[model samples]
Target chain A: MEKRYDIVEIKENVLADNDRVAGKIREELRRSNTCFINLMASPGAGKTSLLIKTIEALKDKYSIGVMEADADGDVDAKTISALGVRTLQIHTGGLCHMDADMTFRGLKELGFEDLDLIFLENVGNLVCPAEFDVGAALQVMILSVPEGDDKPLKYPLMFKVSDCMIVNKIDAEAVFDFDYEACVERARALNPEIRPFRLSALKGENVDEWIRYLDGFIREWRK
Target chain B: MHEMGIVLHIAKTLNETAEEEKITKIGSVTLQVGEVSGIITDLFVDCWNYFKVRNEILKDSELKLETLPAVTFCGDCEKTYPTVKYGRECPYCGSYETWLLTGNECIIKEIEAETL
Candidate 1:
C-alpha cells in the first residue's frame, strides 16, 4: 500500500490576480487617455497637500480628478472637491491598502471618462501600499523631513517600489533637524532611477517645478 | 491588522482549488512566507484560525507557514548572500549595488485535501 499525503501542490502566484486586474485597469485608463498616479506615504507626509497644490497649479491646463482611499472619513475628498475638481472618497472598510479593484470602483464612482489625470491617494501607510498595485502609471511617494532620515532603510520596499520620491516640508527643514541630502542619497542607493523632488507645498517653494514636470508627463501621455 | 484581508484571500483561493480538485474537505495549507514581505506570521495565523471557523468548508483546515530567508545578489561582486544578516552593502565587495533575489513572497505552496 502506498502512503498518500493530502498535500496538493498548487503553485499559483499570489499577486497574479491583482496584476491581471491592474492590467485591465491600465488598459482602460490608456484607452481613455487618463494618466493615473498612485500616491503613497505615511500619515501627514503631505500627499494631500501636494495633490491640492498640483491641482491648483494645473487646473487651467488639465482636467484633473482625485480619489482618496482610506479606512474612514471623507475629509480629504471634501478638501479636493472644494477646489472645483471632481473627487471621490473610498472607504476600504479597515483595509490597510488600496488594491486595483478598489481603485477601479473609485474611478467608476468618480465617473472617470476622458479625464487628463487621476490621482489615487492611497491610505497613509508605507508597507501595505507598497505591496498592492492600484493600476497606476506612476507610483509617487512623499517623505516629509520630519519622518527621519532612517526611514528609507527601515521601509525599503516603499522607496524601492516608488517611481518618484517627493521630499516635502522643505520650509521646515531647519526646524525639524532633517537631513534632506542624506535622505535622497539613501533613497537613490535603493533605487537609482527614482525621480526625487524637494518642495514645500505649504509655502509653495519649488512646487511649480514638480507641477511642470508632472504637466510635461501628462502632455506627453496625451500625445 | 491587514492580515484579515490576506486570510480572506487565502480562503477564497483555497475554496476555488478545492472545488477544482473535487475535494470535499481541506486538511491543511502550507505557505512559504518571505522574511522581507512585511507580513506578520502570528497575526495571519490568528486571523486564519478565527476566519476559517466561519466557513463550513475550511472550518477544520490547518495553516502551516514556513519562513524563507532573504537572499540578495551584488552586481559588483557577483556574489549572493543573506540580505538580513548583511545590509544592502555586499559583504565581499562592500558595494551597495545589490538586488534582492528572494525573501519577498507570500505564497500558498501546498494545500492538502481529501476526496470522498
Candidate 2:
C-alpha cells in the first residue's frame, strides 16, 4: 500500500507580514509629521540613561513621547515618565524583541498626535531587535565600552544595519581597554554610512554633540 | 533568544493554516532559513521542541530547517556572489556597489500535514 501526504507550498516570509505592518506605521508617522527612532543595545548599555539625557536636552524644544519595551517590568518607563514626557510601558511578555505589529500597538497606546518625536527603547538584545524594523525612521544602537570592540565582528548584522552607532561610556575609557579607533573602523567597514558618536551617557561627556546631531536630525526629519 | 517568539509565531501560523485546510495532524514543517537571517538553527529547533509540547497541533510535528545561502548583487558589475564570503564587495569586479539579493529571509516554504 502507498501512503499519501499533501505538501502545502506556503512560500511566505515570516517577517514579510511584520515588514508590511512596519511600512504602514512608517507612512502613518510620516503623515503625522513625527520622527520615530528605535534605540537598540544589549542590556545595561545605558539606553535609558541616554534617553533621559536626550529628553532633558530636547524636551523644551519638541514635544516628546517615549515607548519603553521590556520583557517584563516598567522600570525604564517609570524613569522616562519622571522626565515629564508621555511614556508608555509595553511588557513584551517574555518576548526578546518587539516586532512591527507590537510597535504599532504601542504607538496606538502612546498616541503620537500632538507629539513631534517618539523614541522606542527596544528590548535590550543586540541581535533580535535589529532584525525587526519597528517603523523607525532611524535605527540606532549603543555599545558600551565594557562590551568590547570585537562586537562589530561578532554581531555584524546589528552594526551593518544601524544608521547610527553610539559608543556609550566614553568616560570609562580610562578604566577599560576599549579600542575606540578600531571599533569605529570595524563599524565603518561594515557600514560606511554609519555615523558613530563616542559619548558617556552617565558622566555627560560629549553628550552635547549627540544632542546637537539629534537636534539637526529632528529638524530635518520634520521638514 | 527571540527564537522562542519566532517559534510561537510559526506554531500559530501552522495551526491556522491547518484549520483552514482541514488538517488534523501536522507531520513536519520545512522551514527555509537564510544564512544571514540571524536565526541560530540549533536554538530555533530547541525552541520549536519546547513549544510543540504545549501546542496540540504541533505536539508531534517535526521541524526541519533548510539553510539558504546568502547572495549579494553588485550594481556596478551586475554580478551576484556569495554574501558570506565577499560581503558588500563584489568578488568578481572588486566593486563596493553591491546589495544583498537573498539570504536575509525567515520563510516557511512548505508544510506537510494529514487531512481530517
Candidate 3:
C-alpha cells in the first residue's frame, strides 16, 4: 500500500507557547503599571515569611496584591488578608508548577489595576516552578540558611532562571553553618547577572535592603 | 508529576498544531530533550502513554525521543566540555566561571502527520 505522510518541521521549544502567553501577560502588566513578582522556594524555605516581611515593609509605599499558589490551601491567603492586603489563593490541584495560563487566571482574579505590585508566591517547589515562565516581571527564589549553601549547585536551573536570589534565614546562619560567601559564589558562577540579597524574614534583619531594592525595581519597571 | 505537567503542555501544543495544519491523525511526535533538561525520559514516556489515550488526535500517535547532549563553556580556558560529566566547574580550567552552552532544551523538532 502506497501512502503519503507529511513531515511537519516544527523546530519549536516546548515552552514557546507558554513564553508567548507570558510575554502577553508581561506587556499587559506593564501597561497597567503593575510589577508582577514570581516568588519561588522549597517547602519550609521561608517564602511566605519573606513575603510577609517584604509586604509589611512596602505596603504603605505601594498598593500591593498577592496571589498565593499553594497545592490546596488558603492558610497563607488568610494570613496575608490579616495584613489588610488583597490576596487570592490558587489551588494547583496537585500540579507541581504554575504555567502561564494558571498565572493569567490568578492575575485576572486578583485584578492588576490600581495596584503597583502583585506577588505570585508560586507553588513551593524549586525544580518545577523554575521551569515554567509565569509572566513575572521579576523572578525571585529563596534559599534558606537551614537548607544549606550548596543548593545552588544542586538546583542550578532554579538559580539561573531567578533574577534575584534571597538567602533567607540569615539569622539561623550561625546555627546552620550556611556560608553566605560560598553560596553567593556558587550562584554567581551560574548566573553572574543575578542580584543576591541576605535577609532574615523572621527577625526582620536586612529586610530593609531587600525592600529598598524591590521598591526601586518596581518603580524602574514601570518606567 | 513534572513529567505529567510536561505531557499536558505537549498535548496543548499538539492540538494547536493539529488545528493550524489541519492534521487528521498524528503519526508520531519527535522531541529533542537535553541531558540537563531534567526530564526523566522513562517517566515522560509513561506520562505520554497515559495521557495520549485520552486525547482523540494523539491516541494512535507514538513519541520519538532524541537526546541533546549538554555542553558547557569555560570562561577562563575558553574550552567546552560535557556538562553531565564535569558539571558547573570546568574540568579543563578548574574555573568556577562557566556557563552552559546547550543541553537544557525541550523542543519539538518535527511531527509525522496525515491530513484529510
Q: Considering every candidate listed, which one attains the maximal DockQ? A: 3
Off by over 4 Å in 3: A1-4
Candidate 3 residue A66 Cα shift, in angstroms, is 0.7
TM-score of 3: 0.95
TM-score of every prediction relative to native:
0.93, 0.87, 0.95
* TM-score of chain A as modeled in candidate 3: 0.95
lDDT of 3 by residue, A1-223 (tens): 8556799989989989889989989988989999899999999999899999889888998999999998897999999989989999999999999999899988899989889999999888989998899999899999999999999988888998999999988888778888999999989877899999999899999999999999999889888
Which pairs of residues collide in candidate 1?
none
Ranking by lDDT: 3, 2, 1
By TM-score, highest first, what's the ranking? Answer: 3, 1, 2
What candidate 2 gets wrong by more than 4 Å, as runs, is A1-4, B15-25, B70-103, B114-116
lDDT of each: 0.87, 0.90, 0.91
Candidate 2 pairs with clashing backbones: none
**Model 2 agreement with the true structure over A115-158: per-residue lDDT tens digits:** 89999999999888877779999899999999999899889889
Q: Candidate 1, after superposition: displacement of residue B75 in Å?
A: 1.9
CA RMSD of all predictions: 2.3, 3.0, 1.7
